[model samples]
Target: MDTTLLHQYQLVLSSREALLNYCETIRPEHLAQPIPSYNNDSMGSLMRHVANTYLGWLLNFLQQEQHPYFTEDNHKNLPAIRSMFEQVNLVVNNFLQQYKDDLTAPLNLPREGETKLTLTPLELFTHVITHEYHHKGQLANMSRQLGYIPVDTDVIRD
Candidate 1:
């Protein structure tokens, strides 16, 4: 593996593990409960979005096609959300393995539409990291709004 890319992978993994640790601390019922008066983002909802993004960016548009969306029923359950998290790891790990040699190869993304943007594998991978962190912040805030102390996870722990 490329050492640089490997470092990125570890960072993503560390951050994700940190997130799961926090999620595990919440009671199952609280995991899915909407943060009252917050932006309607439950931890469950943000996680679903993050999980679905792995499928979309790496598995679908970047690597291969996957069902574009998870069924709505899949949302708002801790176990189900956790399953998605694992699935995200699977797809992303597979992607990096398959494309390690082509990190700079350019490709178009989203769809064959006029508005689609082009980026190399490395850039897309970086985008996924930043995007995950962006929503991770929201998840942390959601937990805080619901009265759970926020956990430090937005940065690489090691």
Candidate 2:
């Protein structure tokens, strides 16, 4: 793998691990607590949504594989949430290995009745990572408002 691509992937993986660790710290009882600004979605639901969105992007967009993993309704089930994380991790790792020498190749992501988007694998990786980071921050703020201590690791430290 190119040094730049490897570094980017490392950053993404580290951030993802940190976010998951923070989620793990959440008490099971607090999962159903409603978050501010989000109507009808609890902290747990949001977390699961993030995971499922990544998986969907990977499967439906990147890999062009029509998998029946995520749907609009079932993204919040505990089993689905767990599976989403595991699947995202596995897919990302595998994608990195498979395209280690082709980081510059454009990723032709399939869209629904639309033209595919042109993105490098690295770009897709970064998108997923950054998307997760955005949501994680929201979750952290919700946690704080709920009187919980969230993980406060800086990206530089990871």
**lDDT, residue 123, model 1:** 87
Question: All candidates' lDDT scores?
Answer: 0.77, 0.71
Report each candidate's C-alpha RMSD, comma-separated, in the order given.
2.3, 3.0
lDDT of 1 by residue, 58-145 (tens): 8777765766676556666767876777777777787788778888887877566578778998987888878898888888878877
Q: In model 2, how large is the Cα lDDT of residue 65?
A: 74
* Over 4 Å off, model 1: 36-38, 110-112, 154-158
- What's the residue-level lDDT of 13 in candidate 1? 80
Best by TM-score: 1
Question: Which digits, one per residue and each the tens of the lDDT, describe model 2 over residues 1-158?
Answer: 46665667677667767766776777765666776567766777786777676767766667877766655444444445566677777777777787788877987766779987889877777777778888878878887877888786457763
